[model samples]
Target: MVLRYVRRHFKPLLGIKGLWTFRHTPLAMYWAKLALKDMLVETVLKDENLPPDVTNAHWIAHVVSYAGYLAKIRYEGYDTNDDSKTHWVHFCKDLYRIGYCADNHLPIVPPLNVIQQKQEWREWIIKRVTGGYTMHALTQQLIAYDNDTQLRKGTEVEVLDKFSISRMRVGYVKEVIGHRVHVRYWDTDADDQDLSNSFWCHEQSDAINVVGWSKTVGHAISAPAGYDPAEIGNSSVIKKNPGVNIQVGMKLEAVDPLKLSAISAATVVKVLKHGYLMVHIDSAGHALTQTYRGVESDANHGNNRFCYHVTSPLIFPCGFCKENNIELQPPIEFKTDNFDWNEYFKATGAKPLPLKDLEKEVIDHGFTEGAKLEAVDVMEPNLICVATVKRVIGRLLRIGFDGWEDNYDQWADATSCDLFPIGWCQLMNYDLQPPHVENQEPGLKPVSPGVKRIKSKSGTASRSKRQSATSSSD
Candidate 1:
């Protein structure tokens, strides 16, 4: 009976191959039920014949796709996030309300909270698909920029003169780390080196213009030194390389950003806007078959997923490790010495991100392996510790905290502000922590200033001592 109903009602939608699959499938009843619900929602509740102004086809498609994806995942015995399920139920209720109102000739007015819920649903779906900011988010940022709000230190703004309210005076934002900004009018006769004449006001006060802002409002303004007025009108605010065309499910080799020494087989789980990607390292012991199932809580469950830009030097084409004679950490199933990349790709239906998209000019920061330097400990932000350059992959530097275990190592951009030249701490009058000696091998002296050492053996530190030392330094 279900098959007959589908043949008569959904033949055009499913076509011949789909009908044959449903007929032969054990889950025919389930598919038929889902089809019936979707049909009712589309034909009865949604009223697809409505004018384009009244109905958005793209939005409706996204809603339907989201519902279908969730239902399919649930049917496959995977747990989805509660918020997703709740939103779907709320959407169905909203559709029912609209249909009921139309049938009774009553006004269709949803409560403000219901309206807000729909907006939230829209945003959630976009985030899930895009993995980052959408056009709406970019627009909001532009609005904030145009309003001359969210001012930061070093911003140059135009302020209304206190003595003459009609006159607008250019000013430099001396400080804005706090809730208020300290401004010094450039038109004043006060000495350039003097901050005594600077005045403080709310950071978002209308009295500032953050340089380039006046150009947005059709006003002629003087550009500050090293400021380009043309840059203010450019819409490409997000820092993304051109021609990055990555998609979810594509396969590539990626360095474990945290474990910089290991490169593993990876899959693009999410393709975010502006060339960003959320990739899942397959060698982390999780099967690729379970990639989409329970992804929201993967981190808590010890899954190795990391976000990287498309042009990041850490990610490479499928044959990269083989060509470079580097060790490739394959998925758990293919952990043999004879692991085959071709077989893995065929089994998983994974394609490599095009090499053209990944190609970009590499910047050289001249950092070499085994070089000693000072680095800020990310975990203990206040502490600057002696560190060694462990690996230099393109513009990225793997920094190993000297005398510490490999687990405490970190990867940073070569030009990162977190790293400083040797002796920078002494120049700045900051107390620099020497390499921890407790974890070192017996008779191995602590790393001396300006002395380079080979990679040390993995060492361990007691949790109590580590915590105590970090706290005392703080």
Candidate 2:
């Protein structure tokens, strides 16, 4: 019944009501269409040269055309009084203007009772009969948006300030500029066929890149495929240069398990271990396993974390989560190998080394071979200092220096830097110290694995301590 009523009214308006059908006056309707097109084209071209406000007129004209069409339907149907025609035309015009306010991020103001009364009549006649008109529904939405009083008081400047970073261009340090893109407002004088005031876009010339709080670098920054750091330079400190070991901790600020469709914080975690580096994330005990260098772990280990080749840190807030809604905190500190390392060693019942014996082993493996263990200890402190500085520099440059394959290769092959790591340095080269492998009879015995190992100190230890202290003091 509702659909029938809508179709009954709309059918008449489609050239069946008061006028002769299109068959009788096809030429008249055809010429009217041509004139309308010409008018809009001229307006759009002229708009290109005008100020943003003036340009908005061209956009507004098109909106007005739509509104006017809606008004015409009512006018043609309720020809009973001049008052109805005036009311609809005025209501549609007001609706078009209210939309302008929304596009400019301005608060909408409710229309007067007169406009509301006209809109009510249009809605009852149409939706009750036909399903609903999208344009009519949108107009009603604008009314509701304007009714939010507190939002009306807000300004574009406040929104921009909260979301954008104010920075001066690299070359211009004397005068600071707000690095933001300002959306334009609507123009009222424009024809109904024109666009809205908020259509023009101009990039800021004086400001540097606008660093949105929500923006993040993707993982596409990894070096190209088949990249070999060892091949690029003579970073081989020994016959076999192993890569440095590293552990990572990930901490998510707050997350919801139910809302996969909602906004939340998440972090990526990586870990270092012997035999293979272990990668997994623990956020509030919610774990995600990660893979290292394209290697997969057994299913018994848990879910293998997928690695997206990372050149720059991947920004997860946009793709998987809501923009500007997530904030990541510093990682929860933990030793990656401790839990896994001790378990392997304990299970194997391997002989544990005394601190003195460990020191002697380090001295034997270290450069200036055969040096006294005490002398090696003295040199270890200096090596620790160097590693600390390197980590600090890496962090400052937004570069991860934790012995990733690419990072090590870059450090080893660089030709410009004189202070590059020596072949024996653990920064670019892996430790040569061999682990105690459990020998098993292949025919009948199960294979026993050795314990995971890690470097207690790296070149970045001092720098990390200082950074940790500085952050804590803050």
Candidate 3:
């Protein structure tokens, strides 16, 4: 589904946006051209570095001051002990670099937080002064040139008057693709584009409101469990056994009147959602069976308190007998009679143990003691060990593909591995001549019927009598 959506929408939108970038923006294109020229000149010219003079040194000082300002404020996070709070100092310098400040233009460096640890700040300044020119310097140069050409039409730098040298409309400067600027139009009308449209938001908001109302209505109509079951018919299948809490899908056995204790026949009762299996007893008018209940007491039993938890089942061996050991006989039908309510209660009580606490206990002492201490693990440790060994052996059998054989044993006997194909390749002897022999053509030369070549043990071929005589004569 994701692939289908991307193919239909995202790919085409990106392609169109990418194409429009170079066509629309002039400033973006010029900056790109300037950067490339600078790179070429720097590489070819040996002595391209500007000479160190008084004016040049002053300009370098300003650049260093600005960079230090930026490093202290923009990049690093704030520290209470450090006084590097003035971010605007760097802002004015950045503006100055991009034609906003002219020659002899003294910027009013605003007072801000001071960067602490004199030794560290001094080292940072030294590095900036000595480090070779970077791509950032080239970008700054373009900004400085643009500002000088555009901003200084008539204004002069006065040593006496502290006026704003920061002029020239500085729109947000994005570092577009190293130094080049690329602009593209994003059409809101495009089908593939996901613009912040009011239509989608409005529709989604309405859907959420409807869902909230629906959930409220659903809760109101639902019936509670253990409601009176006398309204429903018959109620004959349910039989009361001492201490047993009758539940859904329970089978009962009928007892013979004369025998008193011997059961005669069996029957099952099916329970419905929030419905009870009503049993008609000999003396009692009606008795309720286990039904769904959602009280706090029923929390461990999946919110079904009246119902006995299914984990502990009351097993009736012969189906009609209450005893564990029973013999199948003629005429008598099978039934479930034994009522083991104690097992259900125990299981239900323990069900609410927290997962983390249970896990901790398991880690400390296994399942027999609550970890994975099954009878198999405790009684047959060697079998478990053998199983682990076989798993390792299987992994080793399927190894060898390429340089990525570091996981050799792990990947070797993977179900996916195959040494050879069936019919052509066998375990002992496989006919692996070539593809040409496998599919022989009419016009093609008949492939030589398999030949068993004898390999020489020593690195030399045995010479025949005639071949030896010819070699000696030569």
lDDT string for model 3 (1-474, tens) is: 211222233322111111112222112234333322111101110122223221221111221121111211221212334443222222213222222223345432211221333335435544543533323335545434432321121121111000110111111111121111111112122232211110111111111111112122111111123322223223322222333344433333232111111222222232322222221111110122211111112112221111211111211212323242322121222122443323433543312111111111111100011111001011111011001111212112212211111211111111111211111111112121221123433433211234322222321111110111101011
**Runs off by more than 4 Å, candidate 1:** 1-237, 257-261, 285-303, 378-383, 393-396, 428-431, 438-474
TM-score for every candidate vs. truth?
Answer: 0.41, 0.16, 0.15
Counting clashing residue pairs in each candidate, in order, gives 0, 28, 16
Most lDDT-accurate candidate:
1
Better of 1 and 3 by TM-score: 1
- TM value for model 1: 0.41
**TM value for model 3:** 0.15
Q: Assess candidate 3 and give its lDDT.
A: 0.20
Best by TM-score: 1
Taking every candidate in turn, the Cα RMSD to the unseen true structure, in Å, is: 29.3, 30.4, 37.2
Model 3: residue 15 alpha-carbon error in angstroms: 17
lDDT of 2: 0.21
Which lDDT tens digits does candidate 2 get at residues 1-474?
211222233332111111111111112123223212101110121222233333333211211121112223122122334432222122322233213434655432212332344556445433332432223324334333422222111122111111111111111011111111222222122233221111111122111122211122111111223422222122221122133222243322222211111122333344322211122322222233222112223323433232211211122221222223222222223323222323434554422211111111111111121111000001011111111112111111111112121112111101111111111112112121111123522332211133232222211111111111101011
In angstroms, the error of model 2 at 71 is 17
Q: Poorest 10 consecutive residues of model 2 by lDDT?
A: 370-379
